[model samples]
Target: MRDFSCFSENGVQVADAASSSNASITTSSSKIGQNLVTCVYQCRLRNFSSFIITITWTKNLMGQGVSVQIDDSTNQCLCKVEIKPWLFTKRRGVKNVEVGSKLIDIHWDLASAKFGVSPEPLEGFYFAIVVNQDLILMLGDMVKDAKNKIDASGFAPNVVFVSKKEHIFGKKAYSTRGQFCGKGKVHDIMIECDLMGTNDPCLLIRIDGKTLMQVKHLRWKFRGNFTILVDGLPVEVYWDVHNWLFGKLMGEAIFLFQTCLSAEKMWASQSILEPSWSGSLHRDPHTQGLGFSLVLCAWKNE
Candidate 1:
């Protein structure tokens, strides 16, 4: 747990200095550039039993950026840290902050981090946290390098990966990579929906090029959920495509996959939800919700 209150002096910027080497992910038309991916984790702190951390990776015509937000059990934001995509001088640094009279340090090294199509790094990087001089959490695959940056006596922090949300853009087919289980195998997710001129549009979802589920007459079945098996575990899939067919131009469809159903027993009640798609009021009772949700906001490009 790094301190975020003093984000100015201990290295702020995180972008690479190689202007020409760093690439922009935007295409010729700018409609497909404003996309971001977010990964949520539930970290149990020494004091609070329920603490949430959200890591958002953003990229566009400008460059790549990273933002971290921490919330306690009451859903109150404790601290936030944002690293800009320009001025790569501060790519690797540390920040210390005081919360509840305890000192916390956050260290990160993204200088040599390898990035894929998204702004998040695939490997060769690490983000570490130390609370009261004790190591609490560590992210990325570089374990040995990260441990070297933390105190030797501190052990690993208790952490659980909760959910993920990402905005995907495509004309008729949307694609993304998702890992359903914890540190599970990453699978290529493809969603195909062609409602161009047909009266009865269809929806199809695939994993690794193999069709897993398909929905016909999507107008009536625009909002619903079903169960499917992936890697021998039951996965609940819910979809809301009401906008993609008739809402507005370039409307996006919402798809959620509650993989593993390991969250809570209350989530099973969402199926018989009286007011469907009204997830607004669901904040209070299900603060962190029940399962590991994979939310995909699929945007269609005209």
Candidate 2:
């Protein structure tokens, strides 16, 4: 791993990694280095696979930056840039919620699957963790901080609504369940998923729900492939493309969209405004990057 403590000319730290797993990069301070603005350094591994570096630090401002680049296929070492945050003692009372609550209740499971089940109202929902602990903790902290802001602001901030749905493929049958928002106004959705638990990153999709479509792990910016469906049948059409980007820390992303590919055949060719959304946090901004945190919030459409 490369140490960018000195090379960051713009207060932005830059590090080059030869090859490392679960790489832990740290800064000299608790807050991101002064006037530090950092972005992911485009990188390439081998000749075909693109490598995006992930940085885990106390705050998103500095420390780690992840970037994806089209294959240059010639460079020996990849440069991953980051800015170091000011390292400070963690505030007290920052504790992990015990693993007492079920990660996903049966109701949520059914709903996420979009299976035909009775709607059981749930106050909140949780998705299993996929990313590193530091990232998760950072997400929890950011959500908590955002909640604190909501409570203190006194003015009613438009709550972003999120609903969970799932699709299942077994040896014999396939089915979907939950409050799916397929054809409606765009809403913010956070999905937690694993593609066969292989960690093979895949885009997530949903069909037959009240919520439109959602993408995961888009802490930066992204444009999605357009697909549509009708009664679980493809219409072979594409709609106006939607774009999702997060400049903030987004906890473990649910990037397993299996239905988006299947939905393209159902829609008529028409230009529609793509849904624009943003998140409040970035990759990981936990107290000390311990990476232990959970998120739950209420949602309301504007």
Candidate 3:
């Protein structure tokens, strides 16, 4: 009888945000919600079966909370659970769920977790999901603790980070960190573009401290994709800053850096996503790694 809220059982959970005095978090879906982070992972069961799991971690007036959703190949959700911010409750717990006649267990520990500017836990935390007694998907840095708590049976699940949808707030310059490959170093990603008064604006992307790519005359190229090298990996960067340059005062921009995939091919396959702000975070679940997709939905703070 855990205090978890079962938002969706074999379906979808509606994202609704309300105001509270909590003061830290601002929104619900991370799309409409401010100060939120959403991560999506594709994992296969030991039986060669696969599914998509979306985890949205949010902070708002009430507190910091997390919402998890599991969906099948057809995008039909299986089960979803929410861990709302609480006081006097265990920051770590376990959940037993049933989806499609399968028994799944979700374990989490974040008692000592430390966070930076983002709501997502940076370290000292773990979120593990077990299905059929196999470690299907696990996240966080406390691997030894995770292994000790769960039964490490069968083979490790073939998991791939399909995509991420993060809402980042900034004015002219927005920055974040990214690891292009599991073995590659995490580089500081900064996107600097000015849309103040100049008509001939430019989009500049920097890795760590070095400028990787710069697009001049951005007004004519506000919506396009390009490839740049970071840590010796070809990362395709897609950007849609239409609203930022033309629409609203504090409009948001969408940028994506998908490695090991051609921005041209991804651009051609508009059916999948088309690399636009309107497109939800999507990727081929069967996509093999060392490939990962990073989406930054940047909202300008006026």
Q: Cα RMSD (Å) per model? A: 12.7, 24.1, 12.9
lDDT pick, better of 2 and 3:
3
Evaluate model 3: give its lDDT. 0.70
**TM-score, cand. 3:** 0.80
Q: List model 1 lDDT by residue over 179-227, tens digit each.
A: 7765666766777878877998888776666556767778877766655
Please report the candidate that would top lDDT against the real structure: 3
TM-score of each: 0.78, 0.18, 0.80
Candidate 2 Cα errors over 4 Å, as ranges: 1-176, 179-200, 206-221, 230-246, 251-302
Q: Mind giving the per-residue lDDT tens digits that candidate 3 earns over 1-302?
A: 11112222321121112212122322222222346888778888867888889899888877787889988877788899888644426589888898768888888898888887677888999988888787878888898888778876843567877666777776677776656654356566677777778878888776655555666677777776666666556677777888888778877787878786555665675543333435655665555543687888888776
Provide the lowest-lDDT 10-residue window in model 1. Answer: 11-20
| Candidate 1, pairs of clashing residues | 1-129, 1-130, 2-105, 2-106, 3-97, 15-88, 263-290
Task: List lDDT for all candidates, in order.
Answer: 0.67, 0.23, 0.70
Judged by TM-score, which candidate is best? Answer: 3
From the highest TM-score down, the ranking of the candidates is 3, 1, 2
C-alpha lDDT of candidate 1 relative to the true structure = 0.67
